[model samples]
Target: SKITDLEQREKAQYDEITSLKAQRDSMFLDNQASQEKDRDFLKQKISDLETRCKAAESEKSSLKFEIEKEKAKLNYERDHLESIKSEMQETINKLMKKNEQLIA
Candidate 1:
């Protein structure tokens, strides 16, 4: 009777150990799945950030181009106005010389 009780106790202990090992394995798998989800989430975020950065860079380039074009237009207008002023001055000088000759 003593031997039989000892054998039963050993069997129960072995069963308990197996149960605990199964629970540990389940927890480990759950942890691995959680880590995988986090990794995927981070990867998606990085991709989104990269896309935004590209868009910002493109916009900056476009704005710079527009600024340069506007500057060129302003320069052209300034030069055109200067040329008109020079022509008007020459006409005035010619008219003054003619008037002086007539008076003399």
Candidate 2:
């Protein structure tokens, strides 16, 4: 009778250990799956950010080109105005000289 009791106690302990091992393995698998999902989400987010960065770079390049074109246009306009101002000064001088001669 004592031998039977000892066998039963041993079997109960063995069953409990097996159940604990299975629980531990299940928890480990769940953690691994969670980490994999997080990694995939981060990868997708990084890809989207890279795409947006490329688009912003393209837009900045286009804006720089437009600014350079505007600078060239402004320079050309300033030079043209300078030429007109010089011609007007020459005409004014001529008119003043003719007026002086008439007064004399």
Candidate 3:
């Protein structure tokens, strides 16, 4: 009778262990699912960052092109102003020469 009672206790302990193992497995599976979700979230964030970087690079290129065009326009204006100043100097010299001839 004692042997039967001991056997019954052992069977109960074994059933309890099995139940605990199942609970542990369930918790492990839940942790894996949460990790997968985090990984997917990180991947999406990385993709978004890459897209933003490309857009910024494109914008920088466009800004550089605009700056070059503005620089060219400024250079052209400076050259045009220099040419007009030279022509005015030549006209003043000619007028001075005429005045000197009249004085003589």
Candidate 4:
């Protein structure tokens, strides 16, 4: 009777150990799957951010080029106006000199 009791106890403990091992394996699998999902989500987020960054860079370059073109046009117009002003000043000097000669 003592031997039989010892064998029963041993069997019960073995069964409990097996059950605990199964539960541990199942939890491990669930954790692994959750980690995989998180990894996939992070990767997609990174890709989206990269695409947005490229588009922003392209827009910035285009805007810079347009600003440079506008600056060049303004400079050309300024130079042309300065030349016209100089010619007008010379013409006024000629008119005043002739008027002074007639008065003298």
Candidate 5:
């Protein structure tokens, strides 16, 4: 009778161990699924950031081109003004020489 009782207790302990193993397996699967979700979220965030960076680079290039064009226009205007000033100075000198002759 005592041997039979020990055998029953051993069988009960084996069943409990099996149940615990199944519970641990389920928890492991749940953690794996959660990690996959987090990885996907981070990937999408990185892709969005890359797109924004490209758009900003394009806008910066366009602004730089516009600034260069404005600088060229300013240079042309400055050269033209300098030429006009030179011609006016030469005309004044001619007029002064003529006035001196008339007075003499």
Candidate 6:
């Protein structure tokens, strides 16, 4: 009777150990799945950010080109105005000299 009781107790303990192991393995698998989902989410976020960064860079380059073109146009207009002003001044000086000769 004593040996039989000891055998039954050993079987119960063995079953308990097996149940505990199954629970541990299930928890580990759940944790691994959660980590995989997190990694995927982070990768997608990084891709989106990279796309936005590229678009921003392209816009910046385009705006810079437009600004440079405008600056060139402004410089050309200023130079043309200066040339016209010089021509007008020369005409005025010649007219004044002619008037002085006629008066004398």
lDDT of 6 at 65: 100
Model 5 clash tally, residue pairs: 0
Model 6: CA > 4 A from native: none
Sorting all predicted structures by TM-score, with the top scorer first, yields 3, 2, 6, 4, 1, 5
Candidate number with the higher lDDT (2 or 4): 2
Report the candidate with higher lDDT, 4 versus 5: 4
Please state every model's RMSD to the true fold in angstroms: 2.2, 1.4, 1.4, 1.7, 2.4, 1.8
Query: What is candidate 1's lDDT per residue for 1-104, written digit by digit as tens?
Result: 99999999999999999999999999999999999999999999999999999999999999999999999999999999999999999999999999999999
* lDDT (tens digit, per residue) of candidate 5 on 1-104: 99999999999989999989999999999999999999999999999999999999999999999999999999999999999999999999999999999999
**lDDT, candidate 1, residue 9?**
96
Residues 1-104 of candidate 2: C-alpha lDDT, one tens digit per residue: 99999999999999999999999999999999999999999999999999999999999999999999999999999999999999999999999999999999
> Cα miss at 102, model 5 (Å)?
3.7
Model 4 segments more than 4 A misplaced:
none
| Candidate 2 vs. true structure, TM-score | 0.88
| TM-score per candidate, chains pooled | 0.80, 0.88, 0.89, 0.84, 0.76, 0.84
Q: lDDT tens digits, residues 18-102, model 3?
A: 9999999999999999999999999999999999999999999999999999999999999999999999999999999999999
Name the runs in model 2 displaced over 4 angstroms: none
Better of 5 and 6 by lDDT: 6
Candidate 3 Cα errors over 4 Å, as ranges? none
lDDT of 6 by residue, 1-104 (tens): 99999999999999999999999999999999999999999999999999999999999999999999999999999999999999999999999999999999
Worst 10 residues of 2 by lDDT: 2-11
10 residues in a row with least lDDT, candidate 3: 5-14
Model 3: lDDT equals: 1.00
